[model samples]
Target: MKKIIFSFVTSVLLLLPNMVKADEGMWFLMFIKRLNERNMQKMGLQLTAEEIYSINNNSLKNAIVQFNGGCTASIVSPDGLVFTNHHCGYGAIAGLSTPEHNYLKDGYWAKTRAEELSPKSLYVRFFVRMDNVTDRMLSVVNPQMTEKEREAALNREMEKIQKENSEGGKYVVSVRPFFQGNEYYYFVYQDFKDVRFVGTPPENVGKFGGDTDNWEWPRHTGDFSVFRVYTDPNGNPAEYSPNNIPLKAKKFLNVSLKGVQEKDFAMILGYPGRTNRWVPSYWVDQQVKYAYPAWVEASKTAMDAMKRHMDKDKGVRLKYASRYASTANYWKNRQGMINALTAHKTADQKRDAEKKFAKWASKDANKAEFGNVLSDMENYFAKTNQESANHNYLSIFFRASRITPLVVGFTKQLEQYLSSSSDQEKEQIKNRLEKNLYAYYDESYYPAEVDLFADNLKLYAEKSSSIPSELSQVKQQYNGDFKRYANDVFSRSIFTSKINFDQFMKQPSAEVLHNDPLAKIATALLTKYYQKTPEEEKLADTYAKAFRKYVKGMRDSKISTTLYPDANSTLRLTYGTVKALPADKRNADVKENYYTTFKTMLDKYKPGDPEFDMPARFVDLYNKKEFGRYLDKDGTMHVNFLTNNDITGGNSGSPVMNGNGELIGLAFDGNIEAMAGDVIFDKKLQRTIVVDIRYMLWVIDVYSGAKHIVDELNIIQ
Candidate 1:
């Protein structure tokens, strides 16, 4: 009973709200009624827990989907019309964009099914069910076993259990640990591969305010996108094929045209990627003081290099647009997190919790289960800090370089070719290299690549624990002039041009690769990495043992508190009210900005601006007051809104639903003031920014001129 209660506190899987407030949790639906139903009902939930998560019948869970592994999406029509965020679908949009048919610059719409563009590698997954496998998993090990022994035993059962219950490879089975391995749950999923892009507003409409407005409230960005899921005629998950038809949605959410108001109930259901509200104070200190600064600096440098190339050419921009946005968003995310965590004194707060736990463990009755946990964790972090810093700092060079990926791939293939005895194996590998591999690097610009190479090499030399010994010699030979060194490496590299790549393909050999300048650099760097980290590995083993004990202690001490595991990209539901920041810190007056209007969007609008520009069609509709059925009584078209729902990265396109299970908005961004939300929940400051469902409908109906798509939705007025 004590263990179960503790599992409820730290795991994101637990529905019980034992934190700041009921609104602070990204809860699992399975335990809703048992822990949260009364409070939820009192707060204005019209649907029962069964109506939200039942497996025997259609429920709210049937409508929500994991969008392409990153964002969330909702089925809005019986024919499987899906709604998600524009940025969530940014990659798919960018892939479909070309200079002649720039769907990114000018919006895209498919009046007919044939016009819907299907990108090569985008898929959505549906959760079939979840099962508590805690007892079955925990039965395999006991306190006497070492972490290695326990893992080996658990692995044996994991394979058998997954194999036994996967429905003959039809369902994707995942068994994830929760509450720091105190509990486990099995989730079954079905992946649909035929999702197609239905419509997207132009850059100005979809990405209004762009970076400036991201993570800000009073936001005006119309950050929504449309999609359609296709499955076999029998309505089964299938690969992309011409024979597939639109999926018959088991359940679909109705779009609410009424919008939101102050104190209105709002809930979100989606896959929230991760959260670490239970991490130790030392870990938070590591990120805030040591690690994140390097990441922010290196990422900003990489983004600058990519943006330089993207700005030079339209085709390059099309290829790198999504990459750049992803880079920029996270770079700023790290910067903001550093600032927010410092302001909140998150580490100090975590230390207080640790102190409480330490006192609890100091009790003689509890000492055996939690002895040395705090000290062990402290030493583990201290020991691993240098290794982590070196790896993260040096890893950016490979991440930022186009040539490194190709070289890595080629080097692997060359090594394999040398060892393989079969003629057919070599031939097969060569064919793939000729056909698929070389074409991927077409978007890379030589000048940017050269510059990035020099910059990263310089950065590594200055920051990494030790530069690769070979590269150290090369640095001396070049008199520490990395620019000239970069030119020498790029100029000699066979991957720099198609002419050289073609030559290398003809006589690919391990000897040639062993002598290659880039390959030598890769080898020396990887060698240094392996040589640098024997101590951290041992400390990590110690940390893992101590972590389990600490969690056990936390559970024992928090017997009265509800505990939940941290998030691990599983489906969750979080509920809260339409809320706002205090208008000013000076008074009791709170500014509950429930929604934004098109008229307000125009206030921040600038003609021909990359971030704020709008298509003339949208401008014309706004000018003429053409909001159709999607406007409020005040005659303003809604664009975006705010809710206090808890969400993180993977919940981007989650449905912001009303009391009656109708879609009101799409969850997109989180407020910057609570950027450290992944580490700690700031109940008062945290807010999920959502694009108003009415605004999405109006854009589909008016701006994009896709009324047919609007007609598909079950619009609730």
Candidate 2:
């Protein structure tokens, strides 16, 4: 371990003086002292690297956490008051909302700790520490080993390492591969599962522009939400309980009421999800030409189907709100990626980079180890492109349909229950399944709404190259009319209704399941979706090996001057100055293109429109110019601002701090022009959208009159 740390730190120190632009890299926190401390100091940082990521002391890293394993969040108060993006907390908020209460629409504020709501499941993971394990991982395999053998060896070693570092399962330990498979790092995290919802703005303010303004700039969404982490009396992780108390956090960020100005130093700390900056051109081609278009079309189809039902009934809307938002957000994102990648010619850029890499690898010194890497990848992708495309289409067809998951999940459990020989075990499984069915009926099952799955499935059949052979008879019976087939199936399937399910459970048999229409479709879909030939699997293994060599060769040959690994949900810090976009008519009213204000947001408001509606109280506040202490120096209430900080999906709700490490804003969205950023970082155009911390405070303290929540924060005026 010492040797690993010493070698890694030495490499970072050697590259310190010649690193890329401040806005470009998603950098590791452990090497900040060697790689970024001096640069950050020169860029206006007031704290040392030790103060930001120290293990011996409670540093800035202690305040940040992986929210619900998918998003990033931060601690803002000693009582463990957590702040994250509104959309990040959407599931929790929606879970607590009902048609009558509609907290998702009207919003909710917990004036006291007792009023805070707990969702069925939610947790936040704090970064405990990380260390290099590449040498130990690689030591288990050799060139003579097949890909399967190598993978098995690595998994065994990884499992051993995880068990060793888990402190007897107290911490969640993950061994993640970086740069494909060239390096590995094990991350230790302590999860606090007793998080409670505190407050959020209504959709009008929180998700102001909805999907229309999701990735676009000049945004007004107050995309922030409040929650609190709770733990046992001894301040240790625990599940939800009435006896739990608010955690006494190790460190929390001080909220800054002072607003940002163009060129001011900005820094962000969070776990960014993923980036594929080193992917080959063929991979880009596959995404743009096949995978993304299918995803976009299928997602839009689901959105349209869900909207039809949601529009007529408020209950349906409340039930499907979170699911719809997720589908719509990605729907727009995938399309944006297509257009952005095409316009930027990102594939061409990758091809040029690969050309250079191939030339470098051709040298006699490197040829034996890396010469065939690019060719192997090309051959693999060329042969599997169509199969890959069909698989992607079917994947979304399953993902976007509510019925498919329940049908598949329940069927799997039923099959397991049938196979059990022990009467005691069978009874327990039956009871659990019965409980789940009741929960689904009460909370999630909406038959009328899910009827749209027929249309979604029809779209899938039309877009995909082929359907499973098992479903070919049904397709032929209806002459490929999926709507008719789906209707016939839904009218008879036992899984479609609780009474039917109860009756079927009394006479459980494999024959009945085989004869069931929905079950047949589910079975066929699963079989075809996962069916890959052995030859194709072998090609995938070959591709993986080649890609790893490609990445390692690029680093060793100095093709990638700054060898920072791509993001894999690790804690990283990115710093840059607050930046402005090119001048545009839409943002002409603003003093600069970097920031947006209430007046501009109101200008785009549409009365009674789901995407652009303005709350009555918000209008009154704006009309009265009731800016209060949250107003910017220019006399307008700033809403969202731009920074050049390198960020991606999981970075949503990350704290965008000033050089002094004071929280100024919460990073929420990215500009649409740089949608291809996941594949390539365009420093010139890519920007991180942030909600001003003052705006969040104004909403909680002034608008909602939650003065006690405001008082918990260490506010810097």
Candidate 3:
């Protein structure tokens, strides 16, 4: 009977082409020549594969980098001028800004090299090279080995791979699993630590739409920011130094003033963070119904609490600006994902695909390896749905509340002290812990806002089926009102303020830490959240093995021919066209839905509005039509444009280059219509939002009169 079921599914699966669209997939650079170059050229790309990626020669790959390990950025000038999104550099900019300087609010431009500011920590990782390591990696594991044993063996081999490729510790080497661990690849990178800020548009312009228009279409934000990478006198990566100079880049993209047109070829190269395009139906269902909602609600709760205090005090607002924007961005994103996944019926689609896969696996030839894979996954997801939901909420609680870390840190240091060997070692640990405790309090502790954040804990407790016992006990004592409990803790706990912390450090006691109210809450949350249940432990081992076999079967059967591995923060090239969505009357004034212009900015502008307000100079320039060379043939200055190039979170600062490989725009966002692009590409709706490079040049050369900066760029008119 099982064989019959498998035979039927196999027939169905063979008939299907796996539904991978021409424009989908974050392809590896090494495979571009064989897998994508021809298709890309047919779509209008003029550059040869060798011109894009070459291990021994300077190519486009040399100009692109992973910005600070989280975003993409490109080198645009011989002087190492780096271009990326303003939001990508927000943390560094905010750190450099003071109440008096207010760089973020008023905007910043380094008139000369000496004016650029270096934050305490900022780096860019240039991709050196990558190679297939599948055979080497797979040799360490066997089918009969448990998942834990497989993982340990693979990790040991991966460490050896890294060491071999590190070239005496000069390069950072990473071994990443692909196709759910059926294959592996090793990447080599060189990190430059002396990156310095160059320029940015004022907050009003950079974040023009703010939270209200973050993931929405028809965006008018000037979202680009500039930085410069510095190196030692010998042009080697080094720590920050006054003696360091701008790097003479081996390759930098030529800035193209010519704007994009509908159907024009577009390509993006960056480190896309993550994707799960081949997951089973159960995983998608769990994310939509349980995980995403919990995250969305928890994020919103924290955002509202932070905003309330932020609005009341300017200093507080400045301090929490980055956190608020980050929380609110995900708050909208998760909700968008929920709406999109449901609207697109993505789960149903996955289910249909899985049925075909199951049938294929059930065949007599394939039955032994994959027959139980789907059942195991389904059973695991079913039992852990609620637990998964609770886990997300608690995770957000820890991230949202700053106090949790303070308590956790103090407790860990105390534990270390107890385990120490001698009085001298204990004293040294005590001194270091005391210093960190004070610093944490100074930077993050805020009693009023933290107490307000605790309200989220109550929300979690109410929404989750189960919670930490310590949290439950607190709820019982406070009659389920977390606000009172938080207030009591803040008033008495040492982690609440430096005065309290300093006093406690003078006479630190393990009993005090063990009995502290905040410590109890923190310990309960941390212990329960990190400790896996026996069921989860068993499932983890089983799930890993099952998925590995499931993907292997798909490939072995030729069902996923030409399928690229999921994005895992590696250098990849995705190419498509400057595609437009269905014409909306809202954008009737513009030529097409592929891009937006200054007119859209004015239309959405609101006086004194945080998101829409424009700088006086910007408004004056728009009124005078001072677009200069940046003006489009349509006689408008393009702000943000759209393309069908597949991208995700870490692709934020990625360069959106044209056919000739000249930089045209900066890929900063994805349209809300296809927020599910992270998991599944909706070829028709998924579009990468880009800031026109011409607009960035205008902001610096014309609007801000920083032409010296423009003189460094290799501009192609």
State in Å the error of residue 513, model 1: 2.1
Q: How far is candidate 2 from the true structure (C-alpha RMSD, Å)?
A: 1.7
Candidate 2 lDDT tens digits, 99-128: 888888988899889999999899999998
Q: Tell me the tens digit of each residue's lDDT in model 3 across 383-402.
A: 88888889888878877886
The TM-score obtained by model 2 is 0.97
Clashing pairs in 3: 6-362, 6-363, 9-359, 9-360, 10-359, 10-360
Residue 144, model 1: Cα distance from true site in angstroms: 5.4
The candidate scoring highest on lDDT is 2
lDDT tens digits, residue span 1-717, model 1: 346535553363353444435578777778776666677888899999999999899999999999999999999999999999999999999888888999887888998998888987899999988878788899999877767788898888788778877889988888888877877888888999999999998888888898887776678888888999999999998888888999999999998888788789998999999998767888998888778887887778888877778888888788778877887888889889999999999999889889999888888987876768999999988876765666666777767765665576777886787789999998887777665545555655677778778887777777877677788798799988988988888887766666766788777766776788887787677667556355655677778888877776776676324345677899998999998665552112112366677776777778878887777777788778787888877767777777888889999999999899999989999988889999988878888888888888788887678999988888887
- Tell me how candidate 3 scores on lDDT: 0.85
Candidates ranked, most accurate by lDDT first: 2, 3, 1
How many steric clashes between backbone atoms does each model show? 12, 0, 6
Higher-ranked by lDDT: 1 or 3: 3
* Superior by lDDT: candidate 1 or candidate 2: 2
For model 2, the superposed segments whose C-alpha errors exceed 4 Å read: 1-15, 419-421, 445-449, 584-586
The TM-score-based order of candidates, best leading, equals 2, 3, 1
